[model samples]
Target: MPAIRPQTLNDVFQQAANQARQKLPELTHNQQVARLYRKSLKVLSSWAIDRDIFNDEATKIRARFDQARGCKPEKAIRLLREAEDEIFAYTHPDPYCNPVMPGGSKFMRNPPLPMDVCFPDGNYPADAPKYEINPDWSKATPENGKAATGYVLVDFGKKNME
Candidate 1:
């Protein structure tokens, strides 16, 4: 429900990935992304159930990928495909069930952060790769930046891309 639950997604795959460890424990970065994508789809589709509004899974948008059976990036993204129609697809006519899409749900939940550090949490590998950002953009809004503009400004979150 609600496009998909990341916590549920993570738990299911984490366990599955562990089981596959003997078969393929360490998947490449790309593979991990792909595996997450596949498992996410499978779990999402399986739970779709018999809904009234859905147009059927055939004509929906989806992210499709292959599971190379590894960790990190186990499931490599192949082609994005929709496995099912929105359970609340008829929201146009009926107002319920609109929350099945990402950002579609109105309910909110609080997320716990691992470390409240301004330091770069960095990428998955801790030191995956680094890219340069325009120094000017890193500055706080003009109001805040007017206070100071130096010191390798670290934003705990303008949100990390990956």
Candidate 2:
């Protein structure tokens, strides 16, 4: 009868890492381009505040992508990156302009009161006392006071220690 050996932590981790690496598919240039095209189309569909306008823009984007279909690997990659950047910049759904009233993409209006002065009463109740940290070390409790020291060295090469 063969003796069964227990798997070490490193062996188990290595097996899991190898499996994860093997599961990832190596996509070809055409596949990558198709994926990007589909993803871009989906993003544009979501960004389309108005359906008709979005459809027109999407059609234009599709035509541009189609024009670069037969381009070389380097050129295709560059074109795809440029297209992604353009799409992101043009259809940015969340253009965070301050004052944030309906559609102001420029300067922010000043608040009626300063942030600190606005909340004069403070967030907590009136009865709650403000906490202040004492500089004296004698008053502080040790963070690991209850932890066992014996097992500390045994955790050498453990998952979290790494």
Candidate 3:
């Protein structure tokens, strides 16, 4: 019978190194163009607040993309670079984001606590003070009576050092 050997630190590190070196599939020209167009439109949307103006600008963008298609490799690369530069130049300082989305203002505003942290081992002490989301939700524990902004800090009290 063959004995199963436990993995060493070197073996774990080698596996991780190989994974890190693995090549991602190269994007074809069409795929690259499509991604750039999508990115450009997103940037344009951030700047153009009015729907009609956005539509007109979007049409112009689509036309430009269509014109660039079927060109020689060098020209296609040049156009792609130009489009990227234009997008970067027009990138908004404060892009409009959906309130619930990751970059939005309301994201994680009233986030729920993880069950593991709330009640470890599926058990909670009955006499312990009830955990509730603070209305003010502040990191600053001010000595003064004024409320602070942001999520509340939780303290589970101290454990015996023994």
Q: Where does model 2 exceed 4 Å of error?
A: 1-15, 84-162
lDDT of each: 0.39, 0.58, 0.72
lDDT of 1 at 59: 29
> lDDT tens digits, residues 1-162, model 3?
999999999999999999889698999988988899898888888889899999999999999888877899999899888888888899888776655444456745878765569788968677754555433333443432336555444331211111
Judge candidate 2 at residue 38 and give its lDDT. Answer: 81
How many residue pairs clash (N, CA or C atoms closer than 3 angstroms) in each of the candidate models, in the order given?
A: 16, 0, 1
Residue range 110-132, candidate 2, lDDT tens digits: 43343336457666556543443
TM-score of each: 0.20, 0.41, 0.54
What root-mean-square deviation over C-alphas does model 3 reach?
14.9
16-58, model 1: which lDDT tens digit per residue?
8898887637766556545544544444454555553223542
The candidate that achieves the highest lDDT relative to the unseen native structure? 3
Instruction: Give residue 131's lDDT in candidate 2 (0 to 100).
Output: 46
Model 3 per-residue lDDT at 11: 100
The 10-residue segment of model 3 with minimum total lDDT is 153-162
What are the runs in model 3 whose C-alpha is more than 4 Å off? 1-22, 109-162
Q: Which candidate is the best by TM-score?
A: 3
